[model samples]
Target: MTAQATTSEPAASEPARRKTAIPKNPGRRDLGLRATLLFPNREIVERYYVPVIYTACRTCYSEQDPDEIFRRALAGDFDSLKMQKLIGSVIESGHGSTIEHVVFTFAISGVSRTLSHQLVRHRAGVAFDQQSQRYVKFKGAATMLPHSIAEGDPDLRTRYEEQVDGALGLYGDMLQAGVPGEDARFIFPNATRTNLVMTANLRALIHMSGLRLCTMAQWEIRRLFQLIRHEIFSVSPFLGSFLAPKCVPLGYCDEFNNRDGHCPIRPHKDRVLEAWAEKAAAARAAGRELPVT
Candidate 1:
């Protein structure tokens, strides 16, 4: 008889391995999520987006009128490099209004309602119009299957699919019985796919990206932002660079859940503060004072 191999679980006494933050790479698989830059293509962005922001920033400091500054920018009188440098500096300095002059519109589709619920929470400098379930009755509504459930035990995965299909079927039955679409939609699960059109200014995009790109964010939404970042990058790499995890610019992770320092992207804020305290203590021993910000 041929020898057989057997798998064994880890010893009970062994410590569980710490989960490290792995940055998500988009386009790995078709999760059905799609984010397309619906407005302001490359040419439009290259010609107007930068100039518009530059005009906003220049008007704040220059004695010239805003219209004149904008006209000169559009006419290519200003050096593109110089405009970008000033814009970069102003953005870094937190002059958010300067970058708010330009906006991007994206047609986001195939994302779950769960993701949309989290996405619509962002209000400032952003506008969203989502597909209304009440107005448009879905003939065959599709649902998102989470990776965990999809990859779990075969029996469980089948059960999850059945549960989702049953809900959708019941919804269809209610509609056939003359029930209102709005009332029938009550049977829809959070996993039901949704479509949205979002328009956000530069400042708001950066702010939203910072929060959503963090390792602590929900996986589905993080993936959506990844797609958003990719769409932005396709138009202007300079602007796309600003869409990053909050910790990348902050220099420390501030999420309360990161206290254990599991996410390796950056040291936890507590660790940073602890190091500062140590330095301060060492300076005190030397009879000197350290500046505290």
Candidate 2:
């Protein structure tokens, strides 16, 4: 039998939950999300990269041997423009495995632990090695102050900074008192800065960029993808063009949270379906069938 609550038992106090406010117009500040591409420079891509992907794409359709195809592609036996056109068309058609032959590595640093936690969730075709909090005893640990908190009322901002500083100060005190670093690190806030090295294949990179570059994505993570896109553009604009919000390629937004259309990047999928329904209804009224794709 379930126990009954005693009349004298004190009621549990619930903390007020803060509503998540996605900034409609966030004033641009340099959020410290740095993504530096560490591999596949222009020379590297120009040399053997396209040939490898082209070979992968052609092997399925051509009677020519794979090695012979790679040989011709690398030696420029085919026009560069023609090769690029074919590759672009293949990628646009959702042949993702062809692009998986190429990879990019990045050195990411100075992002908050919150962002890192989100970053590590992409498991397939990506690898990460992050700085260890359990091992590295930080002497002067840094933290991120979100734009909202920084730009809010000065009194609230001051209080937030003081609370963070107070936690850090206590961490230092605990360490000085011979406490273990791992144990003391429990006090670190989610805003604490972190570093990571990430490597992902082109297919995985494009998949991640699609989700993270959307207007509805968290501002910090969205900014990181912007920087990552910039890095890819530096090396190869052709490949960089493919890294965009999923909605851009789909021509409509599918995020459940965006059904109200607060983010105006694209029309909501529900709205598009509703319009189609109305059109079909009108066609039915006219005793005709609406064409379907």
TM-score of 1: 0.90
In the range 1-293, model 2's lDDT, one tens digit per residue, is 11111122224785654444334322244675579999978889888888888899889899999999999998889888788888888988999999988999999988889999999999989999999989988888888888667767989878888888888888889999999999999999888889999999999999999999887778778878888999999988888998999898889999998998877778899999999999999999999999887
Q: Which ten residues in a row have the lowest lDDT in candidate 1?
A: 1-10
Best by TM-score: 1
Taking all chains together, each candidate's TM-score versus the true structure is 0.90, 0.89
- Candidate 2's displacement at residue 97, Å, is 1.5
lDDT of 2 at 282: 97
Superposed by TM-score, candidate 1 places the C-alpha of residue 160 at a distance from the truth, in angstroms, of 1.2
> Residue 188's C-alpha lDDT in candidate 1?
95
Clashes by residue pair, model 1: none
Query: Against the unseen true structure, what C-alpha lDDT does each candidate score?
Result: 0.88, 0.84
Q: In model 2, state the lDDT of residue 272.
A: 97
